[model samples]
Target: MPKPEHPTDPDVEISASATARELRFHARPEVTVHAEAEPGGECAWGSDRTNLPDQVEPNVTYRDIRIDFRVAAALTDPTQDPSSP
Candidate 1:
């Protein structure tokens, strides 16, 4: 397996409405994982939710969300000389 390269920073915007809450991350992420846990138990990895309910009551406080972007190995290869052409 090839090592992944660093991805560019994504543009994140958070907004809330009367009916719902939304989080928009502008960029194509290679992998997106969302986890919601209670006060003690661990939250397993899950798929991204398009419709996440607004915070009604503070039941769970700890949450983990990760987004990963992978670049092609050919683009980040250091062995190839750029000026060789």
Candidate 2:
């Protein structure tokens, strides 16, 4: 049987508490990634401390966090073709 076709645009949801110190993202099967923090929460992207919120109250749970993923590059032998088996 043939493999099913995956959606070109996919939705990914992440949940976390306000007290969470940091959030990290790792690219899977690709070298590039894009993500955004949903509204109704106090948080920011990247490692620069200046960009983060001043305070994150404890016991606060955040929902509807969404992230998007796409293929930037394949991790494989440079001499080999990426599409080759």
Candidate 3:
């Protein structure tokens, strides 16, 4: 196999970032990423932000989705125990 050109470990100022581009979500989502890099030294860094819809509708299909939840009768209640997961 051909060797990769760039370091997998992102720990330099001379780098680039790309995320959340051309994406559509029916509901708000938790975005999680882990990056290790230093800013400003001898190189340039470019950044792009999360992409949201250009337009939205209220009380329509474009509204944010919600999830309904309730405690099941058969579930063992853990509210009383702080150590419980």
* The best candidate in terms of TM-score: 3
Candidate 1 residue pairs in backbone clash: none
User: Quick one: ranking by TM-score, best first?
Assistant: 3, 1, 2
Candidate 3 structure quality by residue, lDDT tens digits, 1-85 = 1112334333332333333323444655554434332222122222322332334333334333222211111122334563556
TM-score of every model versus the real structure: 0.18, 0.18, 0.22
All candidates' lDDT scores? 0.30, 0.31, 0.31
Candidate 2 local lDDT, 5-85, one digit each (tens): 332232432333233344433322233335432332122222212223324344444343333222211122447664678
Model 1 scores a C-alpha lDDT of: 0.30
**Tens digits of per-residue lDDT for model 1, 1-85:** 1122222221221222222233444433354434333323222221222333223223432233232222221122256564676
In model 3, residue pairs whose N, Cα or C atoms come closer than 3 Å (at least 3 residues apart or on different chains), thus clashing, are none
Spell out the clash pairs found in candidate 2: none
Relative to the true structure, candidate 3 reaches a TM of: 0.22
Candidate 2: worst 10 consecutive residues by lDDT? 1-10
